[model samples]
Target: MYYIVMNMNCEDCGRYIPHSVYKYIGFCEEQGKVVFNEPPTNCDTVSKTTMDSLSSVFGSLGWVYCIDCKAPIFEMEEAVKHIASHHLITTRFMYDSVAAEEVGAVS
Candidate 1:
């Protein structure tokens, strides 16, 4: 298995992110423009279908998170299959039950 390590600080919160949660980081330069993005460790997850529906909206960014508190951030655009990933769901189920609150069907 391969793991990604991010050496950048969280934009929302000023804190050092551990290598464990680092997903992937990339940098792009076009003409005189430069863009750098590092997807966060904690972000919302959604069903596969939802991802396809929102793919156009999400574009390239994956997940969002808070570096200081390690809080989960949400990206409404890319929630489909991304949410079902074992790494994310299992982590929420084991540590926080609040995540499951959104899984139930409402009356």
Candidate 2:
């Protein structure tokens, strides 16, 4: 059975992990049809608020994490193209800055 875990916060980090889910592949002595009221351990770790927003936008497809904190954030947008674009731009800028610094050092 596949479970959609939501509306719960992680005990370890104070991130909002929402809509995090798990697919039960095997049967267990405990955890019957419905498990306890908690996010699945495999779910991304994120803030409760962020999880809520992600749940709203993504409508429960997959999971992700906060780029800055590395906390698993559920219900995040599916296509992270914007994030990737920003990351690429930032990396290029950094590389250019380093090259400029090296040139200046030689001069």
Candidate 3:
């Protein structure tokens, strides 16, 4: 687990951002790109799906931004959590509770 102090300033506020490199996906030298490992068995289904969707959207070069300020947040999962925690705002998932309810109804 490595913590990286980002030298870049926030685009919205110009504040320095610090992030945990290990909290999000990481690059593998042998693989030549960032890779998402398998989620832990304890992980919730929604979170796993969120990560998969984010990876697909951003691929290896995606940047997660703060929902409120549009500043560069950490990576996908961490950014979502950060928004909920720090900003008290929910990060909207495409497969959100409404979708879950619809699926539940169909089943």
Candidate 4:
């Protein structure tokens, strides 16, 4: 589980992380530094792409996080199923938001 902290002190950070998320949320631990103020999105981490970037990522085994529940999606065959079952997820569309920021239409 992750935390959506909303307080000055990390130890004193308060607020619970919501289960359902539809939009992007920004969280930072740095006091006032610009770089630290805004955490990097998925795109920032994948700035450089290798020959097997997509292959390695898709081949890796793990539960893809859901946009709503961030749930453990096993076979989110249908988006509608996500509401009923929090275990369905589509790995390809997982990084849709940052797709445009990547090259070769691979993310």
> So what's the TM-score on candidate 4?
0.24
Tens digits of per-residue lDDT, candidate 3, 26-96, equal 33233344334323233222122233545554565466555345456446666656534543112221222
Error of 1 at 106 (Å): 30
Q: By how many angstroms RMSD does model 2 differ from the true structure? A: 15.9
Q: What C-alpha lDDT values do all the predictions have?
A: 0.29, 0.31, 0.34, 0.31
Listed per candidate, the RMSD to the true structure in angstroms reads 16.1, 15.9, 14.6, 16.4
Candidate 2's TM-score: 0.17
Q: Compared to the true structure, candidate 1 yields what TM-score?
A: 0.17
lDDT value, residue 52 of candidate 2: 49
Model 4 sits at a Cα RMSD from the real structure of 16.4
Segments in model 4 whose C-alpha atoms lie over 4 Å from true places: 1-22, 27-55, 76-107
Instruction: Judging by TM-score against the true structure, name the best candidate.
Output: 3
Q: What tens-digit string does per-residue lDDT give for candidate 1 at 15-87? A: 2222212322211211122222333344222112233433433454544333223454356432333333322
In model 4, what is the error at residue 100, expressed in angstroms?
A: 35
TM-score of each: 0.17, 0.17, 0.26, 0.24
The regions of model 2 sitting more than 4 angstroms off are 1-53, 75-107
Q: How far is 17's C-alpha from truth in model 2 (Å)?
A: 20
Question: Candidate 2's residue-wise lDDT over 9-67, tens digit each?
Answer: 23212232112222112112233323232454655533233334544445654554433
